[model samples]
Target: MAELANCPRCHALFVKGPAIVCNDCVKREEEDFQLVYSFVRKKENRTAAILDIVRETGVEEYKIREFVKSKRLHPAQFPALSYGCERCGAEIREGRLCESCTVSIRSGVQKQGELDDLEARNKKEGLGPVTYYTVNDDNR
Candidate 1:
């Protein structure tokens, strides 16, 4: 069901559906995407840096970064283009977080793994098996 809500981008009344922003904002974003795409499609412009593209084509850097993040822009073709890490805001070619953040997350996982291993080892060594004794009805 669509709910009546104000558009986040333009603050206009719009039906809230699958899209985050209103139709007008979506149209504007499409136009921006087309403009950015046209600029980067040229062989000469393919190697241009994100900042340079922004300066030359008048497209916002964040839009280009969004394209990169969404896999709309291929990094192999555009060598000078990179997106900011979602965590540290450092530049990276692929993925949301940068290498440092990735390493930090990995270290955390390693610590968790160590704790899990220790718990399992303790459970195996500390717990004793329960002894069951069965009495025959004839004996009773």
Candidate 2:
């Protein structure tokens, strides 16, 4: 069998590895990566998320994702600096959704609130005091 080669994007493959393209593809990919990395590293945009980076730079998410992984890159030195879910504040690392959020979403078929359903159930069953919920309106 033919020896594997690195993909221009990932630089990895099985016995017949990836990156079958010649030097030109590699060079182009590298240039694109530099462009993206440079943009992401900018002081004004270092904290941008994957979508923000793509939208701001006009690069496709697909290419941006590839560059992020292939380059082993981060939006910023501090993980907290990286933009993430507005709702959960999860550290996305690369993609828009964090691993935890993704798992949480996948675990349930129907999209629903994290705690809304439980609270609704407790109210329905009249398990008021035992139910987990806020007890103070003005007592705070």
Candidate 3:
């Protein structure tokens, strides 16, 4: 017999079964995995975008995406399997990008945050859109 210590996470004595982790840690991890799996499996939740999961589960977007990518064994088998972008929340079909995101990517690279970005930044900073005066002295 070897030494038996209570798991720090679950506070349960270690066992040599399906898990090297203590039962409590395993249960906690299993619960987290289930939450992630459910979020990925459901259609509405699937399209819920990236930050949604971050907000809901407090897991980082990149880590969540990695989990989705690595956990999926068969690619074609899971046609609907996808993750969302923190920017748009649209389903990333593969390589973590949807069609619109692909286009936006090309366009954003061209502008490099010259347009529309100002508005996003303003919003981020808690400032509403600024009304501009046109050449004709009219509000734009």
**Which has the greatest lDDT?**
1
RMSD of each: 12.1, 12.2, 13.7
**Weakest lDDT window of 10 consecutive positions for candidate 2:** 78-87
lDDT per residue, candidate 3, 1-140, as tens digits?
A: 55677676557777555456687766666676677667656666655555676688765566566566665422354444456665688766556566787788999787976667887899999999898885965765
- Candidate 1, residues 75-100, lDDT tens digits: the string is 88788888999888999999889989
Off by over 4 Å in 1: 119-140
Task: At residue 120, give the lDDT of candidate 1.
Answer: 83
lDDT accuracy of residue 109 in candidate 1: 100
Model 2 spans > 4 angstroms off: 1-18, 75-140
Better of 2 and 3 by lDDT: 3
Per-candidate Cα lDDT values, in order, are 0.88, 0.62, 0.65
TM-score of 3: 0.36
